[model samples]
Target: MSPRQTLTSLIVGLVLPSMAAVAAGKCERLVVTGSPDAPPYLWRDPQDPKHLMGANADLLKEAATQMGVKVELLFAGKRSQALEEVRSGRMDLLADTPLNTGELESLDFIHPPIAQNEIMVWTRVGHAQPFNSLAELSGHAGAMSEKTRVTPTFENTIKEHLTLAKQPNLTQAFQQLMLGQAEFVLAGRYAGLALTQTLGMSKDLQAQPLPVDTPGLYLALSFNSACNDPWLRGQLAKKMTELAASGRSSEAVARNLELWKAQLQQPASTPNQ
Candidate 1:
């Protein structure tokens, strides 16, 4: 490892003891909630429908392990309800969310992002050109999931120029695109890939080379969290920074992508009688 990497490793190694002391004094465990529909990052655990599992879960479990604190990701409800639970202090942490000034009042955001993902436009294999920007799709009718969140800037830009076809999720948005109901579908790169492959439509879809939006997924600690103090925040920041520099988040995404793909490859089992 390089000198910088070595230093990071050392810092990370030393974090747990300090964190353990602080956690012992203030908090016992952390309750986290995340969006269950977002695949590759987080989704409902198949074994236990009420819990979450995926790359985000993997990462959170590792982080909690490093911090010497117990963490449980509960299915509080849908995305909106989950956010409400975190905001009201019924939950301690939220797995992933965008950094918005509006949320700062109730949440303490870690600086480095926990994960990063991109929203890209998908078109029929040969239909997509050497795409570069959203402006390239100016007059084409684009499809998107209403559940997908884009920056306000991108949203306004799309509204002004693109004929967007909104659907409930990436799978349906791509369905619309493939059937010629829409020219393109705006969806997350990894999530879209998994959904298209799961739907057995990967051969027909192509994600545009350029991204419409590239947002870093943040882990926000509720302001009401008992561990949402200076020490906890600082320690979490250090760990996050180390993870980012080490490319752990990216690796987690890639690892989960293969897992998702493997699931699609499995034969359909009989439904419960």
Candidate 2:
């Protein structure tokens, strides 16, 4: 072959593969899912039942906006279903993933978690007890929603040092506390407070000022996601860091907490008599 022809072929070979790599790495959009019942973090939009709306959803949107990407936060059944969707790569992101060692195999967690989940202790008003640390609840019988997840180490500590019951939902867990079936209910501060107001239990129950555990709330991408590339991850991490430093993360949380309250106050629709 001629030297000129061989050089031309080599140039084409390198350029084509480079172009393909760029195309493969492009991430224009992402599909996200998370706990549908986690309020102020995420919850199903009552008006638009198919999508999720709350602090985490809003914050993620803001981050994606900065990266010039469109994000859809959808409600995919329960929290377990949402996790599975991300794990299977059917969904690109999990908005409020807790740090889990086991999940490391299937997911890539972004650094500087988006938020800290304050798992507080809630007890009936008149029954309030001193709660400075998790160790204080050693003998007391506690309850928490089955869907709530703490760190694996914390879970092991609970098993070895605490007596806790897992209930179907936060309301049931709080009910157990109020009925004297359980001493205290462990739950996310905002999530528990939201339920208290909606259930009209705020007057009867109160959350302790101290949290039992504060776990990092992260944004994770599935290993199988088509858009799971270093460029996308770096952009998202940079956006998250900026949001945290700008105090916008706290503002989003406050806004969503109020938004959830207003949504609950809206009168339910009725059929014509």
Candidate 3:
């Protein structure tokens, strides 16, 4: 072959394999999980309990799509169980979860977070009162989902000062407040709003205007994930950070709320296969 043709062929052989290696570094398949009842953020698909859907799901799907990866969102029972699945490496990705020690050890958290969750107080309609801060919550019984985690500062003090009840899930926590069994319930602002609508409890409860804590919700990658390579983590983090900074996450949240609103109106006629 001519020297020019030989040089071109040599360059193609070298460059193409490097490109292939870089592409192969990405995670091809991702199994993501999230809360089964937390809406706006994530929740089990009503028609298919084993699958999940919501804002976080939407964001993850788009991010995974951008990376040419396939995403499978599953519901592994309750929140704690879902977390355990991720921790145990049974799941590759956790779409919406908070930062904590246990998770920190087993997972690589992507930032900036997909969404900022502002937790607030919820009470029965007529029983609602001015709640400016957690200090104002003293002497009142508070309820929150057993799966929910509070900030270190809030937990340190709230644990010692308040009679906070941990219900099995969001529905139960809100139910406790509505039944007068608890004076106030702690939950996410958008999630709470979405829950009330979905559960048909909008007229029965009220959330205080002030937030208790503003925590960012992240997409966590399990340390043992099959797709937990540097390329996967870096790409996912970059996409998630863009979504967070560009307000795409917020827009997705608003869009997902409407999706949930529509889902709430649908009749349950289909079952998961």
Best by TM-score: 2
Q: Report how far off residue 210 is in candidate 2 (Å).
A: 1.5
* Candidate 2 structure quality by residue, lDDT tens digits, 32-68: 9998877787888888989999888999998898788
Candidate 3 residue-wise lDDT at 224: 81
RMSD, one per candidate, in order: 9.3, 4.1, 4.1
Q: Cα lDDT of all candidates, in order? A: 0.80, 0.86, 0.81
Model 3 stretches astray by more than 4 angstroms: 1-20, 125-129, 198-204, 262-273
User: Over 4 Å off in model 1, which ranges?
Assistant: 1-24, 128-130, 264-273
Ranking by lDDT: 2, 3, 1
Which candidate gets the maximum lDDT versus the true structure?
A: 2
Error of 2 at 24 (Å): 5.3
Instruction: Name every residue pair that clashes in candidate 1.
Output: none
Candidate 1 has its poorest 10 consecutive residues by lDDT at: 264-273
- Model 1 over residues 130-239: C-alpha lDDT tens digits? 55676688987778887776776787888898888788666677778778998888888987887777777889897877787987778899988776877667777888
